[model samples]
Target: MKILIVDDEVDILTLFKDVLESVGHEVDIAIDGESGLKKFRNKKYDVIVMDYRMHGKNGIDVAEEMLKMDRNTKIIFASADSSIKEKALEMGAVGFLLKPFDIDQIIKEVEKIEKN
Candidate 1:
């Protein structure tokens, strides 16, 4: 699977990249929404794991823009804020992972989307 992960925190980006790659999935990292969108425009990903809150554009903004470009793109919104899950889904996110989620959880979510 190919995945794009967008997060402002370096640690989170590193951890997710390591975990997802270890499972034999191709992974790309973007530190902010602008960079994420740039990368998204350049390549195709099976799934996008994005942080809900970021510096320039939030996860919702990025997801919305991506959906505008391709409504079939699958997005998984990951955040510490549980309150945004509903909003994220309403904006077309396929999944939501609360921050501090484990590798298993992430993998499960990705696999679920893959199967669908």
Candidate 2:
């Protein structure tokens, strides 16, 4: 699947990119919400994995913005902040993954989405 990963942390982006790539998924990345939204508008992705807290727009903001363009767009919210899960759900995220998660969990979540 073509995946878009948006996060403020460079290491997180690289880690996810490596893991997803190792599993044979095409991936794109955005360092912040503004850039993420820009890239999002310019391309199409099967799934979007985003961080909840970011420098500019934040994940919830990005998700809400994306929903305006495509309500059915599959989204996964990844964050260190626990409270964002409820907000993510309200914003139409399909799944939520907290930071420091096992790679298998990430893969499982993506697989679950693919199955649906």
Candidate 3:
């Protein structure tokens, strides 16, 4: 699957990108929501993994605009805050992973979306 990972932290972005790429997926990383959205507009991604907290445009804002353009893309949010879980889903996120989620979790989530 082609996946886009958006996070302010470079470590998380690299880690997720490496792991996902190693498993035969094409993954791209963006340091912020708007950059991620720019890439999103240029490519066709099966899954998008985003961080809730970002510098300029938060994940919520980015995901909202993204869904408006292509609602079929699976958006999986990974955040430390559980408080926004409901809000994320209500906004059209397909899955939410709390911060510190394992690599397997993301893979499974992507695979689940891929199957559909």
- Best by lDDT, which number? 1
Off by over 4 Å in 1: none
Off by over 4 Å in 2: none
Better of 1 and 2 by lDDT: 1
- lDDT values of the candidates? 0.94, 0.90, 0.92
Q: Model 1: which residue pairs collide? A: none
TM-score result, candidate 1: 0.97
lDDT of 3 by residue, 12-94 (tens): 99999998898899999999998999999999998999899999999999999999999887899999989999999999999
| Clashes (candidate 1) | 0
RMSD of 2: 0.8
Candidate 2 vs candidate 3, lDDT winner: 3
Off by over 4 Å in 3: none
Q: Please, what is the TM-score per model? A: 0.97, 0.96, 0.96
